[model samples]
Target: MENQVFESSEERTFQYQSSLPSLPVPALDESLKKYLDAVKPFLNHKEYQRTEDIVKKFEHGIGKVLHHKLLERAKVKKNWLEEWWLNVAYLDARIPTQIYYNFGGPGPYLEHYWPPKEGTQIERGCIAIWHTLKYWELIRTEKVIVHRYGNMPLDMSQFRMIFCTCKIPGIPRDSLSNYFRTESEGECPSHLIVLCRGRVFAFDAVHEGHILSPPEIFRQLAYIQKRCHNEPDGPGLAALTSGERTQWAEIREYLTNLDPKNLSLLEKIQSSLFVISLDDSSPNGTPEDYTPITKLSLTGDPTIRWGDKSYNCIIFSNGTFGSNCDTFVADLSPCKRLLGQDLTLI
Candidate 1:
């Protein structure tokens, strides 16, 4: 018989897609199962399904809520998982344990969120504006002071310090180690010192500091919340405490309309100070050999450090830092002269 090509009907027309394999459901603990059973009427099978199926369902539901424009914009052309991989990489560098929160004041009262046991001491870079001004004397004396405020403080003193203990890579060794190992000023690590109210200060393990003033930090936080639409309680719950909610709401509303350009200016200054090490060396004499310790975004800000001096270099969307790259270049150009060398503009 002559050789002949053959096609099946199945190949010509697509059949209904096969259902994905049913994921195994873990056996719930007795207490959890009982509780789930009690609430079965309200949640139906969706709440008591296999974890994999539940995750898929949740993803599908979220897809429905996303705006079509946003979905289109977020879609990856290639290597779609790159963002997830990057997120994983970032999370891996974070400290596994939580730090104790101590509100600054006469009483070293611990906050509700303080971990039961101190895990590894993580370095939180830089001192806040308020800490520099309000607690400068105390920080200088004690080397460590607990912040009464929660999270980052709001203040204007953009002076920031880099320390050795943070979970993040590339930070210098602990200040205590530098202090004990070397008395020579040359051996001393470049310190991020805040000079406020005629006082100089640094944060120790027990104390904390921020890069912004209280009002400024608050404004930034408000701006972030407004942009992200975050809420302390789950979304759509308006029954929470009115006083506190109203206060934050007002701040958030005000900041929503405010220009972010000025805020970016302060962040740039502080970020720059964080990466520079005064103790490091520059070919010109002033330390110009500083490498950026933090990964900076072209759209956001870049933290650059040389020796003991660091600064946040802001890059505009156009790949220019600020009005013009030359503007910043001109400002930093003088530092080369401080290195005892005359250099021509690039």
Candidate 2:
């Protein structure tokens, strides 16, 4: 095989998107058979028989109609699962999205160059945020090396959603808000949202056409951390975003009706670039192992997590980092890969 070169990274990255095979709609009978086989462990003989009969009916009757409709829809769309997945797996799910649907992991930084250091959490956090902004810039500029599978480029479309994006709760469904843009595309929001002690603050991450210097980020983060320590606790309204969908919708409605100012506050939260969680817990780990960092990030204070946001950098008091994100795709390697690479940059 000879090495291949490209004039533009975008061309190489998106080369396979149009040629990639479409998502196949499985045959109803085959899928039903697999379902019955999967359920055999949970059901007794008679229960299995009853389920088999029910499955038979579904496969032949209304199930056929539904499958036909799905196939019809697939004929019109390149990927049928896109919208249905958003609806069923995310929007329509009644469970709390943070614990139920979100994916989280500890920063791979501790495993590499930067280890836990007392009193440097904010400093290190700013560094991580800076690298993350750089990663965002890479995505915005189509500079990320194209991921390939067996000589073909995989889809890099979701990179666009990695920053300046959030899920907006609504009645019966939720929608995504993405404000990210490249320099050539147009203006995009360049601010960062800091979450501390249930209160939120905003500051521009991009200062004078560049990501803020580590010192500037340090000052901004220090101010928020100090205010959080001195002031009485905020409403911690972000906790509501972790609630079940319908419950959140109702609570959101009540909140909206309660005060006009609340609506603006919610908008500010849902539209920010990303969230930085200033955690009070000191989840420590040894030099070689960092598993506890991830465990703590997912199980830590619920009030501090904005689960619907695309990214939440959970920074512990000891300068360790873990993260929670509303990534829904099966392949979550992109996030972990990006964060892992960014952890060692500064």
Candidate 3:
């Protein structure tokens, strides 16, 4: 597929959002049949027969009531699976999300013009962050090209969660928070969060109505790196995010109640554009051998990566890159495509 940005006023990217089809609810009997078929291989003949009878009973009883309610839900909601999927598959899951749910990959630029280079971490990171911010601008202006299948448009709603979005944990469930706004909608937060040496810092991505250039970003990153090198390590509060869901939720509530300034700091990190993880591990690997980088992307430095953020760009010490992305909010392929195209600019 090719991408072509829309410059016309009438041809906006999300123009077809209302016309897209709503999520369909499967028939209860058909769903039960498939479930029985899936379980048959694991059960003996008698067990299978007993399971089939149970399934048949349920299909005609309370299952019918639940399916009717689901159908009623589909009539009112465009995508009935949207919130339910987030809550059930992600938020309510008690496992460590960073290792189990998040997606990670080695940067494609290593095989291209930008290979691993020593002492280039801050420099390359600034360039990548600048391009990422540009992509954010495209989304804000609704100028990014929309994906389509034949004549039908696919969902573009995930793009809004690509930046300034986070998942807030609850006692037994979690909820997603998105602070992104299109240019037509109004002003949105333009700050960025930097994670280095177990510390967190925030700065504005836009100043004087213009996004910061790579050089300006470079200076900011340099200062952060310098301070990290000179000072003692921070408390590394980001590490708490890697724990079990309910436990983290309780801790988060306690943390917010500890001090009001702490709550503001947490919100600032939650609503920023995305996270930039300046890591110390330099996993030397090539495009053909990505095992080392991939391992680190998923398992390295939990203190430097926010496990719940929608996107985390991990810049290694040797200037190679890896991405740790939350798969619940959106697919990683779109961001990869955008970053791949932007890498060509450098």
Off by over 4 Å in 2: 1-21, 27-66, 287-291, 329-346
Give all TM-scores, in the order shown: 0.20, 0.80, 0.88
Whole-model Cα lDDT per candidate?
0.24, 0.76, 0.83
Clashing pairs in 3: none
Write the residue-wise lDDT of candidate 1 on 1-346 in tens digits: 2222233332211111122122232223443445556766766565656544654564457634543433453453233333454345332222211111101111011123321122111111112323323332222222222221354222211111222111111121101111211122122222232211111122211212323445543333233223323422122111111113234234433433475652332222222212211111111111232122111211111111111122222211111111101101110242221121111111
After superposition, which runs of candidate 1 have C-alpha atoms over 4 Å from their true positions?
1-46, 49-140, 143-188, 191-273, 276-298, 301-346
What is the C-alpha lDDT profile of model 3 across 1-346, one tens digit per residue? 4345555465677888888889999888889989988998999999999999999888889888999999999999998888887778888888878789999878745557777888999989999889899889989989887877776678888889999998887877877888999989898988888888888877787877789899888888887888889988887888888888888999888988987777877888889899989999998878688988899989999989998899998999989999888877650342231121100000
Candidate 2 residues 275-295, lDDT tens each?
Answer: 889988887766666668877
Worst 10 residues of 1 by lDDT: 322-331
C-alpha RMSD of each candidate structure in angstroms: 25.6, 7.6, 6.9
Q: In candidate 3, which residue ranges exceed 4 Å CA deviation? A: 1-10, 40-50, 331-346
Give the range where candidate 2 is weakest over 10 consecutive residues by summed lDDT. 337-346
